[model samples]
Target chain A: MAGTVPLSRRNILTDRRRLVISVLGVAVSIGLILLLEGLWGGLRVQVSSYEENVGANLFVGEKGVRNFLGEVSAFDSSAVDELRRRPEVKAAWPVNTRFIVLDFHDRKQAAVLVGSVPGGMGGPWKIAEGRPVEADDEVVIDRALARQHGVGLGETFEILGRRFRVVGLSSGTRAWMLGYMFVSHDASAGLLRSPGTASFILVDSEDPAATARAVREELGLQPLSPDTVAENDRRLFAGIFGGPLNLMVIIAFAAGTLIIALAVYSMTVERLREYGIVKAMGARRGRIFRIMLGQTTALAALGFVVGFGFYLAASALITYALPQFWSHVSPAVVAGVALAAGLMGFIAAFVPARRVSRLDPASVYRG
Target chain B: MDDVAIRAERLEKVFGEGDVQVRAVRGIDLEVVRGQVALIMGPSGSGKTTLLSMLGAMLRPTSGKVELDGVDLARLPESRLPDFRATRFGFVFQDFNLLSSLSALENVQFALNLAGTTGRKSRERAEALLRGFGLGHRLSFRPEKLSGGEKQRVAISRALANEPSVILADEPTANLDSKIGHEIARLLRNAATEEGRSVVIVSHDTRLKDIADRVLWLEDGEFREINEMAVDPVCGMAVERKPETPHYQYEGQTYYFCSPEDRDEFAAEPTKFIPDRG
Candidate 1:
């Protein structure tokens, strides 16, 4: 009797049902892996996009800023002026961030309203519908928030027991804590009942490095770079989203691996007698091992294709529903999923290959 | 001339140690010549299959040497045994063990591929072998689709694909119908005589005796040359004679009764006691 024969593409394609099932299992597994990873990627991008649009060089808060969730920030208003007088500083402005429940047209919604200085970098209030806030009793609303609450330009809304007129509708402005709104410094101070004080100072500098040094020395405030701010937001999002995402990815991988492993294992066991026959015919053990491995890899590759298609459909649905938050599907993530699936197939084929290799050709001949 | 393709020297195979030891092949010596079809005939549990396995290099003898083509199979390393089997020996089974997944042609091609023949040449050779076995139209048919005779022919083609020196068939006709069984016996005999290849068949089927160049009888782990006068009068049983008894002949056929009881029975009713003399 010979050993096992070398695997060929023809052998794998010979059984269409096994091929389809193996591929499907791989696809589902890879798709799930891509989905979880994509969500993680999307959250990172969204946070960075928000921070980049804000144009804030340093955020000076009342310490333990993460605990407040932008509800309140207490710092002396004079710190802005002191930071502005330094040679490295180009301009400085006070910013007050407050989270409030607004009653608009009989609907109540949570919103983050930021108090910005007139003509300041901290303000992202580009008027798309009406105009920027001119009087203390007026405010600006983002497009998404206005649509959700059914409030438009020239409408008045009550926030934190104070009535404010919606003077403008803005684009590309979102508050990190809640949704989106913008108001003038005095109106925000009055609404929060804080007098002559702002939450944090936003600074633009002649040179960011020099300005960073000046703020540290003159104002006793730690300067946060734009990159650092984005990083902070990422960490914050991870704190909230990491556990569920990790759990989903781990479970999906395990299930996919087990499904492929068991399928391949059963198929190999069923083919054991055939393997003995082929081996007795002079097929090498290495060749037999390669054939089984090839089958597994082929199945995994097929599954990855289907899985990526599913991921694309899912991503389209999410992007359509939440257009404001940056959501995207990437090929790298899909490839990663496919790789994971292939690895699972390889692992699953290991034990079966061993069993085939150990089968004696003489047993088949014995009557 | 030492024309032996397979030679066993005092071969021993013990199943277990001490109390449970079953001496399957105990100190038996045999030699099978090239181009000869030797039939090892025995009842059940006679260790004929075990002896064949050792001679075929499928099993290692416990204490003695079995050689094929002057190469000591017992001393051959495990790694080299498969190569030895592939290039020097072929095997056929009673069950016609063809892989169900492959067509008859592919099954034969699989053997060629294992022997390192690949691509167009392998296919061409496999097709030629199948066509020679009268399976030209059934070349693409899987084992399940093929008839018993077809499957057996495919098995024979697979066995001969490597053109080995010897073919060891363990009860090749056991699973076939009488007609198919006779066909298989003829095929084995033809392969041995026409192809000039040594074939060793282990079978208790008396039908195979006609096709065999030599038939060796095995009983209680021992083998003896079966001559014309050693054949039993009833049931075609072959008897080993003691020194006291002489051989007997009747109607141009030789007969040997083991004892006086058997001789007395034969004397009273000779026609009823004797098998067909042919």
Candidate 2:
């Protein structure tokens, strides 16, 4: 043709179903990749909900326990009063986290129940619907989990065989893909069956390092700065999901490559004779090769766009349907997936282009 | 100007190796001059197409020299051969070999485009050629929608689009009916005489002979010209019998020569000679 676009594109477009199938194959692979990455970002955000939003500067935990991943640490809850006695401490509050399953309306959902002082230092900053934890049997739930569990204000559910009322709803309080339920120290202490124990203590001291050393030496509990706690939480999630995330990325790369390779290769085979004819007509091997690669490049690019579109739709659905579980779509993440898809397109067409290059011009005579 | 557009000296093409080796074209000596259409006719497996491929630089000769415009095609670099063929030679296949997705005008434009013609120039040149070939009304029609003769005419227009010095056609009239085939042959004849191109047609269809300037009958990897005139082995021209022509005798056979100069050259080195058989 005299046009800029090769006839390969027309041939592919002429068979509308094949073009759509090829585009969809690449789009679905890219969509899956974006979904996994978004979920990973969401996991990081929700897992560090406490340390990120908490106003305290220092945290005191068991000497050997890591940060609050699954909240599997416990210590004497009296550390709060002991830390408060220090002249450098502005205020100190003991915090507790426990993974508990709530039985509601004949269904069970897992939750991470975090308890802090009612109003002093370590509690939810924003409550969307209803009042804060006002009594021993009242709990604050993230709006996302509340919507998911169909429980809102004045709705009561059983936690640890005791009935508790959902009196408040907070936004963005999620951990480990589950909801974070906030309660008073006393109520959570009762839930843990250790009335005076706390998993950690948050201190709002201006000089966090000095206060941390003082708390560590006097109380024998390791006091960590907030940054260290947040970093530890991020690294912890990386350790937990790193292998699976790597595997998913590899699968995404392979799926995209194979889809392009198979599509281009089969098209090349189907038009092998046509390619020979072009060769005989004084077309260089590179010309024919470009036509084949051009097809794959067009397909991959279209697929990438479609995949990105799918991700946008999915992200919107996630935002609307699941408010507590946030799946972030970062620019870097999108660029990385697009680059991978482009690389797959470039590499995938190599074999088929090679086939086109090696085709003998005399083969057209065979027809 | 050089009249000889394509000249082959003992051209040969072999397929495979060892036990399965087959010689497709065996030592055929031929030449087609400008403003002339030379046709090669043979049954299947006669190496007609194989010989055409070597002559057109589409395939490498196993041994021998095929030259186009004094450039030895056998010695041409692989990278330069495509440009050489595109710029210097055109090809027409029997099946019309038009890209089915392209319109008739676009088909001619593709040939011009491959030789680096584009934009308005490409379109204008393609239009002029197709219009000249009486295909002005079918410029936008694709091959599948056109009749066999129309498709072949479009193919001929494509061959002439680049204004190549020579057109190498493989079975140019094999697919058309007798009437359409003759029309295609006449088109080829005009391409050579009116357009002043050298055309080489390889086909099994003898219907092309009425318009052919010279015809070669190929069989068993070798060929003999069907023309009554004899080709001067030294000067590479079909020499007619005349009182002014010189003659040479070798092994009880009388050879009429184009000139005394050619007669002297052949008489000195007869062992290197490749002569036409009766």
TM-score of each: 0.80, 0.86
Task: Write down the TM-score for model 1.
Answer: 0.80
Quote the positional error of residue A211 for candidate 1 in Å: 1.2
* Cα RMSD for candidates in order: 6.8, 10.3
- Let me know the TM-score candidate 2 reaches against the reference structure: 0.86
Interface RMSD of each: 4.5, 2.1
Error in Å for residue A167 of model 2: 0.8
What DockQ was computed for model 1? Answer: 0.28
Best by lDDT: 2
lDDT of 1 by residue, A1-367 (tens): 1332324345566678977776677777777788778777876665555457766665555544532232356877888888778777777788787767866677666777778876775665366888877778888888767776677788887778777898888875543224667888888888878868878777777678877776677666666777776787677767888889889999888877777667667777876767776676555677677767776666676777788887777767765565444445467765667678788768766766788888886666554
Error of 1 at A223 (Å): 1.5
Clashing pairs in 2: none
TM-score of chain B of each: 0.81, 0.79
